[model samples]
Target: MITVLVIGIGTGSPDQLTTEAVAALNRTNLFLVPDKGADKHDLATLRRELCETLIDHDRYRFVEVPDPDRGPDAERATDAYRAAVAEWHAERARRYAATIRDQLGSDGTVGFLVLGDPALYDSTIRIAESIRDDGRLDLAIEVIPGISSLSLLAARHKITLNRIGQPVHVTTGRRLPEEYRPELGDVAVMLDGSLQCKQLLPKHGDLTIYWGAQLGLPDEVLISGRLGDVIDEIEAARNAARAQRGWVLDIYLLRP
Candidate 1:
């Protein structure tokens, strides 16, 4: 049987890994870590370090899979985004299939180490789904959850995620409109290529913003204040850090 485990490691921190996640890591005969190319090696390196720290299996084979880059393009007619992602996923599944065949001999356990929670803003589940579509993963597929970026932000800041009777909306920064706000309570924005908060509060601002870059890393940066007060600084700092690191993974929370 082929047991495929999707484990969430959570934000660059070894401590962020839950007990169950660690157990799953040790149980896997194969580990799949995606190389986001040269630009984002830190991400892949972090996953490697986590395994080195928590896993002590002699037969634990590590496979660095290549990610298919979805270039900058609009998804207009023919559902370009869906098609592009499908192609990318199929390529990933092919790689996974080859790895499975070579490593486990068609029946063993493998773990796909995903950053943060696999179910949130992560495409690993999709890739696993692709593997399933190919009828490759006949073994039990287990999802081991871990701390998420939002949880990390809340824990680091010592704040609750939402008001007593309020709802929180988690969304990508790309979908943000010209004006953004916490509809009824709070909003957690991720995958922010553009500073959605800045665009929303261009000039007029009266909201509480909590931001974090590289959330759980050593070079982590956090800023919280009135939106109008720190928007420029946040933009400058975010830009500088992106230049320094070549890329940045960040998320922010807004409450009103």
Candidate 2:
């Protein structure tokens, strides 16, 4: 049996690693790093940097795991998009299973570092569980949680995720229109590049938005104001930032 530690490393920064997370990194002798193509090369670099900075021993080795493409993040309908994502996860499971069998021994311990908490928007845990369910390898999985981008978003902006006693809603950009209304209190939107935010401005102009991109990195950007007042500015900044950096991971809070 192998132990798979799905560690949450937080947004692209070494300081975000919890004491437990750091310990987990050092405990594992092999690290599986995800390669998200040229556009996301920086992401892989960040992961490498974390291992280099935290792990004191030279005994650990890393293997690059290529990401299976799930196609463009286009504006697809819910069912179509979900089906596409399911297929993508299946392919990833196949690759992961192959890697585990080829690289890890029955007694081996390997680690997969995910950005933010594994329970958040990340799919690493799901992939690992799927691999285990396949019966190709006996995998004992452990999840180490870290500061999520959502948590940092609120921290950077100095606001709580929810309004006084009001509920906080978690949603994706695609479902924002259907799931959120100005009366919903505080809504945290992820997997949205502030692109889907445009659709909401037409009806909820008075709503305020607290947005941040590259939350923990040096290129971090924050914009907050009335939805109608700053929507254009945010859109332009997001596009320009993504163009310059080749990638951006952002989260935002929409408040009524």
Candidate 3:
């Protein structure tokens, strides 16, 4: 049987890795690093650097598996989007199964270093479950949680996620409108490629946003103010980040 550990290494900092995550890193016989190509080569390069710095021994090896594209239509949240995501996940599962079968010993451990906690807006967990349920390999899966961008976003802003006894609501950029009621407390928005907050400013005049991009990385940027006041600033920052780094991963807390 092969045991796979889905370890979260946090957004972009080595310090974000938990002690257990680091220990799991050293235990794996093989590591699967996904290559999304040159535009995101910085991502793959960072993973390789992480192994070089953290792994105490050279007994292990890492392979760069070319990641399958979920494509353009999958970017939206809709029935077609769901279908595209399902197909993309299926492709990923096939690649993962082939990698494990070809490279791992029956009893060896494989590690997947996720960017954030697997339970939050990440697909590695589902893909691993798919492989296990297929019954083609004797596999066991484990998860070691790491600091999520949401957590770090809160930390960087130095604000609690909730107001008083109210709870924090989490939703994606596309679903922001559905979850827009401020009475529900603070809403943490993620996976927003478009500046969806602009739409809320007209009606929700009191909306405030605490936003950050590339949280733990050197390119980190933070903004906080009334939505109407800072939306343009956030957009400018996001655009500048994408222009310079060719990519930007951002999250924000909306207080309504």
Per-residue lDDT of 34 in model 1: 77
Q: TM-score of each candidate?
A: 0.91, 0.96, 0.96
Instruction: Report each candidate's C-alpha RMSD, comma-separated, in the order given.
Output: 2.2, 1.3, 1.4
Per-residue lDDT of candidate 3, residues 68-177 (tens digit): 98788625668888888899999988998899889985779989989979889999999999999987578899999989999999899999898888899899888887
Model 2 whole-model lDDT (C-alpha atoms): 0.86
Give Cα-based local distance difference scores for all models: 0.81, 0.86, 0.88
Q: Lowest summed-lDDT stretch of 10 residues in model 3?
A: 69-78
Model 1 per-residue lDDT tens digits across residues 28-142: 9888887778878877778888888988677688888787676663433447766876787788888887778778877889898877898898887787777777787565678
Clashes of each: 0, 0, 0
Q: What would the per-residue lDDT of candidate 2 be over residues 1-256, giving only the tens digit for each residue? A: 8999999989848899999999999999778887788988888888989899999999877888898988865667778899999999988889878877788766688899999999988888988989899886899999999899989999999988987789988988878877777667888999985568788777888888999988898889999999899988888788877998798788888898
Off by over 4 Å in 2: 73-75
Clashing pairs in 3: none
Quantify how close model 1 is to the true structure by its C-alpha RMSD in Å: 2.2
Candidate order by lDDT, decreasing, is 3, 2, 1
- For candidate 2, the per-residue lDDT at 214 reads 85
Candidate 1's TM-score: 0.91
